[model samples]
Target chain A: MADIRSKIADIYSLEQLSLKKSWVHDRHPLVKLASTFLFIILVVSFDRYELARLAPFIFYPVILMALSETPWPIVLKRFALTLPFCLFAGISNVIFERKTAFILMGLNISVGVVSLFSIVFRAFLCVTAVLLLIAVTPMSRITAQLRRLHLPDIFVTLFEMLYRYIAVLLGEASTMYTAYMLRSTEFKGLQMRHMGSFAGQLLIRSYDRAERVYNAMKCRGYDSFAARGKKKRLSAADYLYLAATCLPLIALRIIDVRAAYSIVF
Target chain B: MIEIKNISVTYPDGTSAISDISLAIGDGESAALIGANGAGKTTLLLSIVGVLPAERGLISVDGIELGKKSLSEVRRRVGMVFQDPDDQLFMPLIYDDVAFGPRNLGLSEEAVEKRVDAALSSLGIAHLRDRSSLRLSGGEKRIAAIATVLAMEPTMMIFDEPTAFLDPKARRNLINLLRRLPHGKLIATHDLSFAEEVCPRAILLKNGRIFADGRTGELIRDDRLMDECGVEALR
Candidate 1:
């Protein structure tokens, strides 16, 4: 239960970082959102064997971390959470393909080894781009941008509600789990036999909570089409930031700095 | 003024919560709706906002009937503070929650900012404007919930179990705050002492009917009526 509580606290640490009044955080959310999307697309478009070319993309995360003043440990901790699936896929490639690609440390390295490294690198780049975006842009701002994009209200509202209540629901579930653990002395966790009632109770509680929330919303004159907070237009600096981010990403994808450097050296 | 005429509400499952209840609250008046658990206090309060459809009756606020067309306008005029502050304060930050109602009402940015600031400062929670709702203490959450509704500038206010989980100091503070508000207030509570302290008029509901209605002091002092209503005498 304490672990659940701490995890809930950790979920908001990035959001806390987003609140800081820095240049990156102060830029328009739509610009940040579009630039991040472009960066991820560019990073993922690399060829499977383009590990050397993908190396320069590390500058994006490094520069973003320095500019935003977000701690490296926090970003890396979250980045670690995305590694398992990439590791599994990479390991499979290493097992299936063994054709030699290069020699290093007096030993031949297989094409599979290179591809595995490429996959892991690509995953890291893509995850870092997204993490930096969210680390600097608040969720409300993101939703506001979604509204500006003419997305359907149901989708936007559902996203907002899910983000807001997920922690509360998780807290309720953890408290119930603690009570259950205290009751049965012999069991380590909730047993399969009691799963029916355990899950049913949570469902009923959530349903009742949803109804009460709807009533509260209705009492506040929230018709389905009620006006939301209008977002301000992007300033000249915001456009400059967007161009600075997107143009470099596009250039990096088209002309690999690694290829250019190797020929010059 | 608020008026309910023979309004009865029945759940879809055929359980009748309120049966032919008639009541009226004059302008600038405060009333306590006293009832035991499952005695329809919440249903009655919800009905006032047109949230729960009444099976048969008419509810009017200052001669404007509550129907499909007037519900939006009526809701704007009547603010409700729900039993659980968690349910009412859904926005990520306290400022947004306080601004939610006014924003929905299509207020301009300057006006919304003014109302939110005034509401928070009035509740003495101006310091919590940027804090998330999940991080607030129970008392702070309750105060923030009230500020959310107050920002809408409602003429009347309704509270459902406002002091359900407050500590003694917090309860006293809330009661004091309630005393200073000038709007017509209808507080549905099981707290007998609370009713006597804040309300001059009281209506007792039993089994979906009004069992008693009179001055709060006289009604709560009557041991026989208090016993019959299943509420404890003043403590």
Candidate 2:
């Protein structure tokens, strides 16, 4: 239960980081959002064997992290959480595709190996781009930008609520787990037989809590329309930030920096 | 003034939560709704703001009867601070949560900002304007929850277990703050000592019915009534 509580705290620490003052943190949310979206698309559009093309994309996360004063360890820790799934999706390539793509150090390098590295590299860039976006921009600002973009109210509201209530749901689960552990003599965690009832109880508790939360929201005049504050117009700096980050990504996607380097050298 | 006359509320499953409960709280009056667990304190509060519909009878806030049509107006007039601050402070930032009601009231952003500032400053939490409610201390969260309602500029305030998770100092701070506020208040709490300190009048509920209603001093002294209602008298 304590572990769960700490994890919940850790989740909010990212939002805390977003509150810090820095150049990247101060960028308009729409510009930051657009740049991140463009970065992801460019990174993901690369061919499986073009790992070198993705190398320059590292500059995005590195530069943004430095500018925003976001700590690398926290971002890396969250990135690690997504590593396993990326590996799982790409692992099969090593076994199935064994064709030699090149020779390095008198040894054959398989296309499969290159592709797997490319997949992982792409995943890193995309994930880090997203993490950087969120680390610099508060969730409220992001959701507000989404609303400004004319996204469906239900979808945007769900997105915002889901992010906020995840902590609430985990807190509920932690409390119930603590109560369960207190009652049972054995300390090997919950038994399989009790798992069903435990989950059902958690669901019921969550439902009750959700209903109360909704009532509270309604009392405060929370209609489906989210209350947005004054809309901020994009400044020249915002456009500069967007152009500086995104134009290079687009140029890189079209120019093939690695091929150009080989020819020039 | 807030008034409830013969109002009875039941769950959708047909279980009676509160029945034939009638009470009136006048302008600038601070009253404590004292009751045991499941004594319908929460249900009655919900019905007052029309969050929970009454099966029968009438509830009015300042001569405006509560119904589907008057709900928004009633809610605007009566600011309800929920028992759990987490439930009340749902926005990402305290400023946004505080601004929520005013924005819904169709106030200009400038007006909303003023209301938020005024509310936060009134609670002495102006520094927490940009802070996330999730990261606030228990006491701070409670105060922030109150600010969310205060920004609405309501005529009356309702608190459900305002001191449930507070330390002694925080509880004392809350009591002082409540006493200083000029709005009419209906506080549902089990803290008899707290009730005695902040409220001049007390209404006791048992089995969803009005057990007693009188001055706080007389009711807290009635050991018989206190015991019957499953609430301990202040030692």
Candidate 3:
């Protein structure tokens, strides 16, 4: 039991959304998937000042995550690692340099800074959406669902193959590293000419390995350029999820948040 | 049965791997493809499995002509166990790796489970059902890789260097396991002993074609053909 738990933990970002003792691991992956995607759309459609309106949307993912019984610590850790990208984009608001009039407590502030913050906020939501999506849905199922959702098959295929195949290639790389370490007494720096040759050799070797891998896959009767696995279906909850979130985003977009903000200003 | 007629293979990088070679294997028959390193054994194996496109030859599995259209069907029948167990076992767990073949066949859940169990038990790795294939030992992984395809129930099996590096005992054990399986096998190897044990017929490979053909016992005894084809006599 402990072995399986550790194995599952190793597979997922459980610290951010750690599984509880009674958590059902078999819930629809589509639930988390749909909510995350819809949240991305809603977050991206916010008005420049409607930034505060986006705060509530964060809870949607957090709530689904909590209900799904994913480990908060693990999920939070994943979110923390991802925070930097949004922060970097958000900081651009600080350097927007454009001066525009905005009232905060009867004082004027730069709207460029606000717009920049909006961009940052949008990025944060986007990143969080992706992290939550993956946290709930293992990458394998996510790629399959992407294929089912009419996402460009090639891009989705690239992601699926890389994720599935890298484990074996990384094993080979580590073995090479082990052999190199065992043979050499004192290998100081990896910047030498011989090291370049070694790296180049590794590249060629991995390519050969990939050729072998394609052959092996072929021999197993695998022709699905996508992937082979039992896919989690799009359930009713998932459909309702798309409706609950996307409906609002589309409606607000139609209502024109920019026009709404203009009237308020 | 797999039949290759007038086949030629050149890699996209402009190097010919195999050229204008023809051969046939009957149902339930085992044949050994002997070759030195770079003698195109792997390419020939891939051509049978439709991984490598033959420049000029007709290859068929189970009586269907193999080209771009029939390639997938050809692949479905001819199971090729690769040289490296690492590349072959891609799934995380033993069961999933074994199930990969049947799952591609689009079998139902119950059917896939039954096939997975049967393959694992037949390979004598049923105890390894939940274990990580990547963490398994070399011998264990080799068996697991074979079982991965066995789950598909392919009648024709191709193994490229089934036992390249192994302790004497594990190599012997693997040979024994192969002997017990009922599937027709095409093993390409420099190990004359393993070839003799697994297959009685031999095709000596040189310069991308079969240089000599004879019974394994006869060919292994023929020092002239053995030396000429670069197949060293096993002492």
- Please name the candidate that would achieve the greatest TM-score relative to the true structure: 1
Q: Tens digit of lDDT per residue, candidate 3, span A10-111?
A: 553332232223222344555556656666766776676566566556665566566566556655565567567766766666666567657889866676
Model 1's DockQ? 0.61
CAPRI quality of model 3: acceptable
Each model's DockQ? 0.61, 0.55, 0.36
lDDT of 3 at A265: 77
Off by over 4 Å in 3: A1-32, A47-53, A91-128, A172-187, A192-202, A224-265, B12-16
lDDT by residue for model 2 (A188-242), tens: 7999999999899988998888888888889988765544544788999999998
Candidate 2, DockQ score (0 to 1)? 0.55
Total backbone clashes of candidate 2, pairs 3 or more residues apart or in separate chains: 0
Q: Candidate 2, A71: how far from true, in Å?
A: 2.0
Worst 10 residues of 1 chain A by lDDT: A222-231
Candidate 1: regions farther than 4 A off: A1-3, A263-265, B62-64, B108-110
lDDT (0-100) at residue A50 of candidate 1?
81
Candidate 1 local lDDT, A111-162, one digit each (tens) = 8999999998899888888888878987766876777778898898888777
TM-score of each: 0.91, 0.88, 0.79
RMSD to the native, candidate 2? Answer: 3.0
lDDT of each residue in B147-215, candidate 1, tens digit only = 999999888899999999999999999999999989899999988788888999999999899999999
